[model samples]
Target: MHKEGDEIHIDEQEASGGSKEGVVRWVLAGGLILAVLLMSIVWIIPAMTQGDIEEEATVSGEISSMEGGDSTDSIVGIDGEPGDGGEVTQEDGIEVIEN
Candidate 1:
Protein backbone atom coordinates (compact mmCIF):
# COMPACT_ATOMS: atom_id res chain seq x y z
CA MET A 1 0.00 0.00 0.00
CA HIS A 2 3.04 2.37 -0.16
CA LYS A 3 6.23 3.19 -2.14
CA GLU A 4 9.11 0.66 -2.34
CA GLY A 5 11.37 2.65 0.01
CA ASP A 6 8.64 2.96 2.62
CA GLU A 7 7.89 -0.77 2.50
CA ILE A 8 11.56 -1.60 2.88
CA HIS A 9 11.95 0.77 5.85
CA ILE A 10 8.88 -0.72 7.50
CA ASP A 11 10.16 -4.28 7.06
CA GLU A 12 13.60 -3.40 8.43
CA GLN A 13 12.14 -1.75 11.51
CA GLU A 14 9.89 -4.73 12.14
CA ALA A 15 12.72 -7.20 11.82
CA SER A 16 15.07 -5.20 14.05
CA GLY A 17 12.55 -4.55 16.81
CA GLY A 18 13.57 -6.06 20.15
CA SER A 19 11.95 -5.74 23.59
CA LYS A 20 13.81 -3.87 26.38
CA GLU A 21 13.10 -6.68 28.85
CA GLY A 22 14.64 -9.24 26.50
CA VAL A 23 17.82 -7.15 26.17
CA VAL A 24 18.01 -6.70 29.96
CA ARG A 25 17.58 -10.43 30.50
CA TRP A 26 20.40 -11.26 28.02
CA VAL A 27 22.77 -8.75 29.71
CA LEU A 28 21.98 -10.17 33.17
CA ALA A 29 22.52 -13.73 31.98
CA GLY A 30 25.88 -12.83 30.44
CA GLY A 31 26.92 -11.04 33.62
CA LEU A 32 25.99 -14.06 35.71
CA ILE A 33 28.08 -16.34 33.53
CA LEU A 34 31.06 -13.98 33.69
CA ALA A 35 30.79 -13.75 37.51
CA VAL A 36 30.73 -17.54 37.81
CA LEU A 37 33.80 -17.88 35.60
CA LEU A 38 35.68 -15.28 37.64
CA MET A 39 34.74 -16.97 40.89
CA SER A 40 36.00 -20.34 39.64
CA ILE A 41 39.35 -18.80 38.64
CA VAL A 42 39.68 -17.14 42.06
CA TRP A 43 38.92 -20.41 43.86
CA ILE A 44 41.02 -22.64 41.60
CA ILE A 45 44.18 -20.52 41.53
CA PRO A 46 44.65 -20.73 45.31
CA ALA A 47 43.71 -24.39 45.42
CA MET A 48 46.37 -25.30 42.87
CA THR A 49 49.02 -23.20 44.63
CA GLN A 50 48.31 -24.58 48.13
CA GLY A 51 50.51 -27.62 47.57
CA ASP A 52 53.68 -25.48 47.78
CA ILE A 53 52.62 -24.15 51.17
CA GLU A 54 51.91 -27.65 52.45
CA GLU A 55 55.31 -28.84 51.23
CA GLU A 56 57.02 -25.89 52.89
CA ALA A 57 55.25 -26.65 56.16
CA THR A 58 56.38 -30.28 56.06
CA VAL A 59 60.00 -29.41 55.21
CA SER A 60 62.82 -28.30 57.58
CA GLY A 61 66.49 -27.38 57.36
CA GLU A 62 67.68 -30.90 58.23
CA ILE A 63 66.36 -33.63 55.94
CA SER A 64 63.91 -35.93 57.69
CA SER A 65 63.15 -39.46 56.57
CA MET A 66 59.74 -41.09 56.64
CA GLU A 67 60.88 -44.69 56.22
CA GLY A 68 61.80 -46.89 59.17
CA GLY A 69 65.56 -47.57 59.39
CA ASP A 70 68.35 -48.28 61.88
CA SER A 71 69.77 -45.18 63.60
CA THR A 72 73.36 -46.57 63.67
CA ASP A 73 75.66 -48.26 61.15
CA SER A 74 78.70 -50.49 61.88
CA ILE A 75 81.73 -49.43 59.88
CA VAL A 76 83.33 -52.13 57.76
CA GLY A 77 86.84 -51.80 59.30
CA ILE A 78 85.77 -50.99 62.90
CA ASP A 79 83.00 -53.26 64.30
CA GLY A 80 83.60 -56.23 61.98
CA GLU A 81 86.33 -57.70 64.23
CA PRO A 82 85.58 -60.86 66.24
CA GLY A 83 85.07 -60.60 70.02
CA ASP A 84 87.59 -62.20 72.46
CA GLY A 85 85.09 -62.75 75.31
CA GLY A 86 83.71 -66.23 76.08
CA GLU A 87 80.17 -67.16 75.06
CA VAL A 88 77.48 -66.24 77.62
CA THR A 89 74.75 -68.66 78.77
CA GLN A 90 71.22 -67.67 79.99
CA GLU A 91 69.40 -69.50 82.82
CA ASP A 92 65.85 -69.47 84.12
CA GLY A 93 64.58 -65.98 85.07
CA ILE A 94 67.71 -64.44 83.53
CA GLU A 95 68.75 -63.37 80.08
CA VAL A 96 72.22 -62.69 78.61
CA ILE A 97 73.87 -61.84 75.27
CA GLU A 98 77.56 -62.71 74.54
CA ASN A 99 79.86 -60.15 72.95
Candidate 2:
Protein backbone atom coordinates (compact mmCIF):
# COMPACT_ATOMS: atom_id res chain seq x y z
CA MET A 1 0.00 0.00 0.00
CA HIS A 2 1.30 3.51 -0.96
CA LYS A 3 0.04 6.77 0.64
CA GLU A 4 0.51 10.28 -0.82
CA GLY A 5 3.03 12.65 0.87
CA ASP A 6 0.32 15.02 2.22
CA GLU A 7 -1.80 12.11 3.50
CA ILE A 8 1.18 10.48 5.23
CA HIS A 9 2.33 13.73 6.89
CA ILE A 10 -0.39 15.13 9.19
CA ASP A 11 0.64 18.49 10.66
CA GLU A 12 0.40 18.87 14.47
CA GLN A 13 -1.62 22.10 14.09
CA GLU A 14 -4.30 20.29 12.10
CA ALA A 15 -5.01 18.02 15.04
CA SER A 16 -6.17 20.84 17.34
CA GLY A 17 -6.44 24.17 15.44
CA GLY A 18 -9.63 23.38 13.53
CA SER A 19 -11.87 23.76 16.58
CA LYS A 20 -10.11 26.69 18.29
CA GLU A 21 -12.67 29.28 17.23
CA GLY A 22 -15.61 27.14 18.28
CA VAL A 23 -14.00 26.37 21.64
CA VAL A 24 -13.34 30.06 22.32
CA ARG A 25 -16.94 30.98 21.54
CA TRP A 26 -18.20 28.23 23.84
CA VAL A 27 -15.94 29.40 26.69
CA LEU A 28 -17.11 33.02 26.31
CA ALA A 29 -20.75 31.96 26.30
CA GLY A 30 -20.21 29.84 29.39
CA GLY A 31 -18.53 32.74 31.17
CA LEU A 32 -21.41 35.06 30.33
CA ILE A 33 -23.92 32.52 31.63
CA LEU A 34 -21.94 32.05 34.86
CA ALA A 35 -21.75 35.81 35.43
CA VAL A 36 -25.49 36.17 35.00
CA LEU A 37 -26.17 33.27 37.38
CA LEU A 38 -23.89 34.76 40.06
CA MET A 39 -25.54 38.17 39.82
CA SER A 40 -29.00 36.64 40.06
CA ILE A 41 -28.07 34.66 43.15
CA VAL A 42 -26.67 37.71 44.88
CA TRP A 43 -29.76 39.74 44.11
CA ILE A 44 -32.22 37.01 44.98
CA ILE A 45 -30.75 35.98 48.34
CA PRO A 46 -31.23 39.43 49.89
CA ALA A 47 -34.61 39.91 48.28
CA MET A 48 -35.85 36.64 49.69
CA THR A 49 -34.36 37.30 53.11
CA GLN A 50 -36.07 40.69 53.26
CA GLY A 51 -39.49 39.18 52.50
CA ASP A 52 -39.53 40.74 49.06
CA ILE A 53 -40.64 37.46 47.54
CA GLU A 54 -44.32 36.64 47.63
CA GLU A 55 -45.46 33.45 49.33
CA GLU A 56 -45.99 31.77 45.96
CA ALA A 57 -42.70 32.85 44.31
CA THR A 58 -40.53 31.44 47.07
CA VAL A 59 -37.63 29.31 45.89
CA SER A 60 -36.05 26.35 47.64
CA GLY A 61 -33.08 26.92 50.00
CA GLU A 62 -33.93 30.62 50.31
CA ILE A 63 -32.56 32.54 53.31
CA SER A 64 -35.08 33.52 55.99
CA SER A 65 -35.31 37.03 57.46
CA MET A 66 -33.47 37.80 60.72
CA GLU A 67 -36.34 39.55 62.45
CA GLY A 68 -36.67 36.80 65.07
CA GLY A 69 -33.22 35.22 64.86
CA ASP A 70 -32.11 37.30 67.85
CA SER A 71 -34.71 35.50 69.92
CA THR A 72 -32.09 32.89 70.79
CA ASP A 73 -32.41 34.19 74.36
CA SER A 74 -35.12 31.56 74.84
CA ILE A 75 -32.52 28.82 74.65
CA VAL A 76 -32.40 26.97 78.00
CA GLY A 77 -29.00 26.51 79.59
CA ILE A 78 -27.47 23.14 80.34
CA ASP A 79 -28.89 22.21 83.76
CA GLY A 80 -26.52 19.91 85.60
CA GLU A 81 -24.17 19.76 88.61
CA PRO A 82 -21.69 22.65 88.49
CA GLY A 83 -18.22 21.43 87.47
CA ASP A 84 -15.93 21.39 84.40
CA GLY A 85 -17.30 21.86 80.86
CA GLY A 86 -19.77 24.53 82.06
CA GLU A 87 -21.88 22.22 84.17
CA VAL A 88 -24.54 24.06 86.24
CA THR A 89 -26.80 23.28 89.16
CA GLN A 90 -30.47 24.19 89.43
CA GLU A 91 -29.90 26.93 92.04
CA ASP A 92 -27.07 28.46 89.97
CA GLY A 93 -28.77 29.60 86.80
CA ILE A 94 -26.63 29.96 83.68
CA GLU A 95 -26.85 33.45 82.26
CA VAL A 96 -25.31 33.98 78.81
CA ILE A 97 -23.93 37.55 78.96
CA GLU A 98 -23.66 38.72 75.34
CA ASN A 99 -22.47 42.25 74.94
Q: Please provide, for model 2 over 1-99, each residue's C-alpha lDDT reduced to its tens digit, 9 standing for 90 to 100.
A: 235965665565665656444788899999999999999999989776764456425544233433436545443434333442344334457554321
What TM-score does model 2 achieve against the real structure?
0.33
Give each model's whole-structure lDDT: 0.58, 0.58
lDDT of 2 at 31: 100
Candidate 1's C-alpha runs over 4 A off are 1-21, 52-99
Best by TM-score: 1
- Ten contiguous residues minimizing lDDT sum, candidate 1: 59-68
Once model 2 is optimally superposed onto the true structure by TM-score, how far is the C-alpha of residue 52 displaced, in angstroms? 10
lDDT of 2: 0.58
- lDDT, candidate 2, residue 24? 82
What is the clash count for each candidate, in the order shown? 0, 1
TM-scores, one per candidate: 0.34, 0.33
